[model samples]
Target: MISASSQQKKQLQKYTMLEGERKQGQFPLLEMSHLLYGGKDQFDKFLERQNFFDTNPMFKVNHDFYNKSRQDQILLNAERTVEAMKKLSLGDPNYYTPNVLCPQGIFISTVHFAMVIPAFQVLASDDQITKWMTSLKNFSAIGCYAQTELGHGSDVQNLQTVAVFDKQTTEFVIHTPNIEATKFWPGELGLYCEFALVFAQLQVDGKGYGVHPFWIRIRDKETHKPLSGIEIGDIGPKMGYAVKDNGFMSFDHFRAPLDSLLNRYIKVSRDGKVERQGNPKVGYGSMMYMRNILCDQYTKFGGRALTIAVRYSLYRKQFKDDNKQEIRILDYQLQQQKLFPLLAEFYACVFGSIKIKELVNDNFNRISQSNDFSLLGLTHAVLSGAKANYTYFVSNCAEWCRLSCGGHGFAHYSGLPIIFFEMSPNITLEGENTILNLQLARYLLKQLQHIVSKPSAVPEFFKFLSLETVKVDDVTTIDNLIKLLGLNCAILTKYAAQKLMTHSDMKESWDTKSGIALAKAASTFIPYFNMLCFLDTINNKAKETKEILTILARIYGITMLLNNMQGLLLKNQLNSQQIKTLQDTRESLYPIIRTNALCLVEAQGLSDNSLQSLIAPKEGDVYMNMYNFASKENSLNKQQVHNGINYIQKMREVNAKL
Candidate 1:
């Protein structure tokens, strides 16, 4: 084994080699990356944010952050949040900067900004905004999105927390009837947040109006104690995303003012009479907002995971070549296959996210301008599938990146494990993948409802549904792969619609029985939509980026094809030779991608401080960095000396005596 001193001495050679590798790229990677960031201006913001986080002592991870206890982490997160907000507000209040620059996963403040604030932005009335927006911005009233209850998550319509409009007092009495009705997993609610935009069943004159948003103050501002009629506390540790302060809260006839109902589009008189002007589904504005936010987050987080995996795979040398020279792990075909496809998928996600966000914004804007919710259902359907598919797939990508790191990936020091914690919960939160598939599947079937009568009225995606016969030839190109995938969806949708029509006699809906088919149809749209978006992104870009991006998009399409092979094969959409073609195409592209692997990851511009991986430093000083990370009180070059009185040695002696 090399000594610590020797590891330090060889670090310079590693840095030189890594610099040479970084300089090997042919494309203008830095300029090309601006497209992923939205534009050059946004990329500049990202760089500035990175510099601030990297330089700020307050933001620094001085020790093993994963080693911190929940309470310690909470304190650290709160402190950093304050400092970050102060600095972020000094010039441009680009709220997105915090989320994009946050080295850690979603934090306490992230929920406030991403969910609660956006919800208010889209849903709150002018007066309501005037009343509460200041409190939210100035940190006088930190807010939590209290939506998911212990029993009724995803089924928002069935939530049990009731806020009844009291006729005499003109007040809404909010109550959580049982333990299961408690708001269970809202971030920032456990300790820090003082307020919540609570979702509860609204009752007026004994008639129920399904779940509606209520502005409720849970804790006192000065003392930070739960209010008289509310019970609030932390939900404790979870599978992942534990760094954020997810918490539980319940109410005991909590009396809030009539104005607290967030009645932007509706009004309630003193006599408990309800007046409304807009669609109630428009109340889903908040949910829609978050789903869009998550689409972008998947790309960013996926990029981070691939950055670590790709960088480490390059920096760490493994088995020797025939010439007795140590070979980089990335030199191997298997490593390239594992990482490059993920790299490609990350780009696809980038393009898809931008498009999806734009679509969501357009939908919201239309509604805001004219109360036009005609396209709301369609947009929601798409978002439901996008959230479910993207989160489920990208979270798995992070895990794949972890696994690709081999045994060392299992270690916390590699930073891949942290990516798992950051990404895994996204699959379940917002909406669970299976349930969301069913939701979108239901919407897809709705489109077929009128297809037989008014065929041309159906959306472009379902245009193939009316076709008598469809034939897709060899899938040599990305477009062909996407067409094959689209054909698979058309088949699944038609099959599902037929099953429903034929089996209307069943006790439950046919969907309950044939849910698997519905989910499969929904899940596989994953690649089709992303491929289209990626191609669109490529078409809009200049020739310089279009070259590298087209190659990446092809690889992404192939990877997605391989992943859906079983479904495609079972559906007869892809034949044996076609599948082999896809495999061959992916393999052919690997070397070309490997040539720019370091360049591609570098394009993501992830700071070493943000990554926190001992294995993924830009300088490529793997051994020395690892040594430094393990030095001092962490585990200095000291003997394994005993405790208080050399008890380990004494125990050995005692064992000998025995």
Candidate 2:
């Protein structure tokens, strides 16, 4: 059972200014507790569940059943989590939300929900869905996603596994031609997954097509051992997600019927003619779908870190004041400076995530009914860029949150370390950030080229891009700042896109000859996309908020523009004085942001319970909980070893001298 002290310790809460003072409003500790529990219980009943941490029915089942039984249990837990996901949808009024469950839990519970079920739901034929969907939903059968290969993870077009169709047997023989073709890095694949949504090169009648997912059995039904022609094993420890059974597999002439191909979107006939529905890119829609959800997922990622950091900040105290009272570290300008900007970013990401979700849902609805999918390609392109930007920014800020808390920040108890570990993997997972940014660059280029070919094709947003030169000559005002931000992004969007098109025919412009060249192209384009993202946020802020946000938007834009300031100077587009003015304008914006540091953080609707760190919580009796925690027997036991050994050695030396 949970001790009273432990229960009291975790009854962490915060209060904020009223809604008139802040947009997202303030959730009191009681309200937050309600929000967390979906209105079922008060503090007393909530603590009761905390007692069963080691053997909670839900928690234990995930480990004992899913982690141990491996394949079958993986599917089981996935189905449970899928049910949980439906319960936890934002649209639901009474969702039982946990504290954002950490990466280990998120991966263990969500891999199947997010990766496997969706692949089958979107890809499988009606008959296949009839056969498998219910079993998948009920957890009688389990599935894992298998697309990333050991050698070619992000490059979808270059995977080496082959599924050649046999006319006589009417089966597709799945084969791993070499060790490099081995499927790797699929979560829960080694032990937990019974079947896999396998992506492999499709060859029929001597004609080859690119990768596609085929549902294939991976383990025996009764024995639970690897099936014939299959080799499966763990990929060993990774930096994060230790509990997740991320694993590797190789197929040796595995056989499945011709009907195994997920034919909802794409189909291979006996004659080898390939028929596809709507857009060919729709076949690769899982990645696109995940990328869309990642915006909100990443916001929560940063919010969790911010929660830890903010709470810790409130709870940590440094030097005593003149009255000999300790001051909270959050009071220090340097501390606020280090963390508040990131706090604002967390808020921006939250709002941005909401927007993206709306966009994705609306577009999906349109595509479903009208079959007009012009937005699918655009949504995919926009989201891939935005996801990369937000994840990277949030991950970087999480590290800074670590530094802000000093020594305790490094401790696992502080929670920043885990948050960082969880978030850092995102830079590479869905799509490598750099390569994905370049994909957005292609979209931008496509738009610019269309407008150039037909001047009437230009979006009104691109009118600034059409200008031969963009000028920043106006006097300073908040309204002007906001306008300039939008204008700046439009110009950059037009310029970069047009530049790529003008240079597209030159082989040297698209050179992958060196890492430096490749990185330059990626770096140049992502900032343009990020600028647009920031301006998009700036446009939505309330008047007073927008005034401040405009400053931040200007700083963000000017920072990118300054990277090529020399080019701007050489081309006579910017005088030295103008560059200095922009720098001064950016430097000035930081202080205006600094004054409202506490209010800004609170406005994000963040609570001390949410942040769960030393540096970011509500201003309070800082260090009381931390000191109590530090003074605990278990916590002290960890530090006791070195102190105890030193004392013993000292005593022995003194006795010998006597």
**Top of the candidates by lDDT:** 1
Which of the numbered candidates is closest to the native, going by highest TM-score? 1
TM-score of each: 0.91, 0.76
TM-score quality measure for candidate 1: 0.91
Q: Per-residue lDDT for 6-36 in model 2, tens only? A: 7666544223312222332222334323322
RMSD of each: 3.3, 7.7
Cα deviation of 653, candidate 2, in Å: 18
- lDDT, model 1, position 209: 72
> lDDT of model 1 at residue 227?
93
Residue-level lDDT of model 1, residues 26-75, one tens digit each, is 67886777878877888888888878889999766454666667777777
